[model samples]
Target chain A: MSGEGDIKLLGMVVSPFVVRVRMALHMKGVSYEYIEQDLFNKSEILLRSNPVNKKVPVLIHGGKPISESLVIVQYADEVWSGKGASILPADPHERAVARFWAAYVDDKLFPAYIGIMKAATEEARAEKAKEALVGLASLEEAFTQSSKGKPFFAGDSVGYLDLAVGCNLFWLEAIRKMFGVTFFDVGKTPLLAAWAERFAGTEMAREVVPDADSAVVFAKKLQARFGSNTSAK
Target chain B: MSGEGDIKLLGMVVSPFVVRVRMALHMKGVSYEYIEQDLFNKSEILLRSNPVNKKVPVLIHGGKPISESLVIVQYADEVWSGKGASILPADPHERAVARFWAAYVDDKLFPAYIGIMKAATEEARAEKAKEALVGLASLEEAFTQSSKGKPFFAGDSVGYLDLAVGCNLFWLEAIRKMFGVTFFDVGKTPLLAAWAERFAGTEMAREVVPDADSAVVFAKKLQARFGSNTSAK
Candidate 1:
């Protein structure tokens, strides 16, 4: 499977989640065909492969489709272990802790940020934005706890947990612009802010992440039509 | 650490998540203390132990506090490997796949369920209810694909991933009532619906689950103040 070209990823360039799958694959040095899908108008291949979710960041191996970004990242980590990048902790407990926070970021924080973007009044939006900062503050502490004295979320190298949490960094910036707030300030959240910067600068993440300008454009469009972004509605 | 009085879980009986920890403990036949806390007016011990998240379901073993349900479930599985119920697979790839969907249920699906419970409009609420079903349908297929001929989610015995995903079954009925919908029809989502019934009937789950009457009382309070649950706002 390592030498074969049977792996393919269905995703769009702008989705931070899709970028997460791409970054993990790149870090593992696993070659794969990247198929960009128009989410508004789905492709037959994408729909058939991922019939249940009908969403991007689906990894197809020989034909089996795996949806969910974190799932895709885990699949990549397990499939290419010890080849290029070992993206998961060897110790099971440490691995569980890493996974806990990754789920935390996706489960609790992102939706709060989405709420902030949808807030109607300036005062309401500001309050919502402040609340989001509090959530980020908790994440900062969690990162400090998980990373301890290491460079990445899991340990010495970027791993499953790091990739799972790292994808949300782009969304953090997007919400900051959307609500005129800056929650990821280094002074306030040094550990997590540094982690985000490090992840974005990584060769794998750099190759996959949408450029800052494009991200800003995406965020503004989402903000302008915040009410309609099914995610929040 | 496995000796008597060595492992203690600090939490109340009211929280489903804390019950998740308790269920895992019972499944593994691990002995532990059940400490109660007033979440609205949290105890100092709870705050210090889980300073990062300030949440319940904290597991203390050999003088260390491990917060988060999934992490604690994994810890329980690791410590009580062969006592009774063995959660989590030995094979790395199967373990990875299990962990992936467990994360999916907690991260993506549960939030959508929460949204449906909190929605202000009937249409918006119905839409979120559908989203929750979409998520459940994905889980249904994952169960079908992985379970194959088995009766459980991760095969013979209830695994960590099963505990992780199964923990939410009790809440589905209550949450569905809040949105005036039943997204998980036993007839429609046969695999998942049957899985939920099987998981719910377990002795551990049966003992901890709040009765239908209590669930109605709890959910009604949430409905009364649906717009004020500021966790997402």
Candidate 2:
């Protein structure tokens, strides 16, 4: 698995999920072909590669397609054990904690973000925005629980947990602009804000992340679509 | 952690998630005080233990509360390593695959089940039922990709994955009974069906799991409440 190193990734450049996989690869110093996807009309390769999920951030290493962003991150970490970055902690307890937080962010916090972005009315938007704020607050607490004054989510060095949770920061900023609200209070969640700033300023994030302006523009289009939709009513 | 030997679980007998933690502990051979909760009037311990989530299946080991069902399962597996059941696989790749499917079931498939159970209209009910079938179908495909010739999700032995995905089977049955439809075509998904039977019949499952009759009865009560609201409308 390690020697046959012709790695390829299929995903859109704009997706935060795609950026997650990109950041993992960048951190691990893995060379991979980045193929941009038109999600509206999915390519045959993307479809065939990920028949189950049929979503972006599919990693193909030596002809094996690994769907799911976090799963792909684990695969990258496994493949580049000694050569590059170690995304997972060696200790099982620490690794479990990292994974638990990662799952928590994806499962709980992410829905709030989605709800805020898709709310129909200003009232609904505000309600969802408030919930998102609470979720982010819990995440801030998790940062305090695990980091214990460390720089990253897992510890001093960036790991899988950071990439999984950190990928959503761009989406968070876009949602705030779209919904006309700010959930992240930098003063209150100083540690998390610092972590976000540090992770976002990394070479991987800077190189692979969608620009803030473009993300906001994309979010605005989604918001407009939700507004015009009869279903939203 | 093992030497402490003073673990207690606060939860109800009815919740599948509570059963998840119970199964993990049973499999791990971890001894604990099982305190049944009154969901209507929650105990102070339940509230104090899980302040953030304020939910059941809270594992208090060594007087520390670990909230969230899956998190508790992971904690049990880690803490009680020398116990009877090893919930998670030692191999990282196998563990990742197990976790991936478990998350898929929790996030995607279970929501479809909830939608079907809660649908007010016959048309909406049928549509949601169809979605649940599709979710199961995707799981069937995921099994084909990974499970292949394996007996359990993680080979011969039942692990964390079986417990996670298996907990949903009773809910599917309950939902199907409420809607007067069959979701899991035993003839179609033989392996999944067999696996479900295996999991349900396990001593751990038998001890903790409530009968499908009870779940259907509870679901019907909820549906009736909703139906009354619709009639008022």
lDDT of 2 by residue, A75-158 (tens): 678766776789877765566567767877777778877776666666776787778777778888878877778988778877
Docking class of 2: acceptable
- Give the per-residue lDDT of model 1 (tens digit) for B32-123: 77788875688887988887678998988766788888788887787667677777776655776687787777767888877776666667
Per-candidate TM-score, chain A: 0.87, 0.91
Q: Candidate 2, residues B1-233: lDDT per residue as tens digits?
A: 35646788998776788888878887877778989987668889988887666788887876766777777787777666766767877765566677678778787777877777666677877787788778777777666656657877767777877788877777777765656668768887776777777778877778878888778766656557666211211
Clash count list over all predictions: 2, 2
Fnat for the candidates in order: 0.47, 0.26
**A51-159 in candidate 1: lDDT tens per residue?**
7568898888766677788777867777667678777677756776777777777767767776666666667676767777888888787777788878887767788
Candidate 1: residue pairs that collide? B87-B159, B88-B160
